[model samples]
Target: MSDVMDYNSRLSDPASRKFETFSYLPAMDAASIKRQVEYLVKKGWNPAIEHIEPEYLMDSYWYMWKLPMFGETDVDRVLAEAKACHKANPNNHVRLVGYDNFKQSQGAAMVVYRGKTV
Candidate 1:
């Protein structure tokens, strides 16, 4: 048997460490991001945007971007809001979250933008 160990350079670097579930994967492009928003809407989950400075990512709560889009179904609108939040907070890490009303909890969450590296 060959003894080979897999080493990920990002794993050793704090700045490159994963934050959320999708963080482990490559960064998502515009079309991919839009698809995730579509999935959230299709699932009937309320979409919300949240952001925080990279240093404060470990904190439990993040600043909400406006308010949760309670009954929002338009994928464009959701993407627009997320874009706006990222534009406003260019240095902060922005994420999209899906709140499940039936389960009274968050059903999905993913980081859409990574903060600028210092």
Candidate 2:
């Protein structure tokens, strides 16, 4: 399957759907996400948040703000931003992305939101 289709492989007929937004993996609760973020931080990776609308799912890029969480050792800040983004865009896709100093792109990512949570 293509990278886009990999977002939601369980769909029986994805082509028939109007629009869909999903994370690469199952959604992670706030605590679980915080733990991962903390781990990355300890490994010297900076945290950032991104989101994408379902209609724009064809766009592989995740929209990240210019200012990432830098020089911040607190996981609460990262958790807050992740929750805020997800709350603001409940129907959209949101993720916590981490970047290392040497990487031009996200080195690690976790899905904080995947549309409606069941």
lDDT of candidate 2 at residue 80, scale 0 to 100:
84
Residue-wise C-alpha lDDT for candidate 1, range 25-110, written one tens digit per residue: 78899999999999989999999999998877778999999999999999999999999999999999999999999999999999
Full-model lDDT, candidate 2: 0.68
lDDT of 1: 0.90
Model 1 stretches with alpha carbons more than 4 Å out: 1-14
Cα lDDT of model 2 by residue, 1-118, tens digit: 6664533333344333333222434455666777888888887888888887655545668787447888667888788887888778887777777888886766787666665422
Q: How many times do residue backbones clash in model 1?
A: 0
Clashes of each: 0, 0
Question: Candidate 2 at 44: error in angstroms?
Answer: 1.3
Q: Tell me the TM-score of each prediction against the true structure.
A: 0.87, 0.70
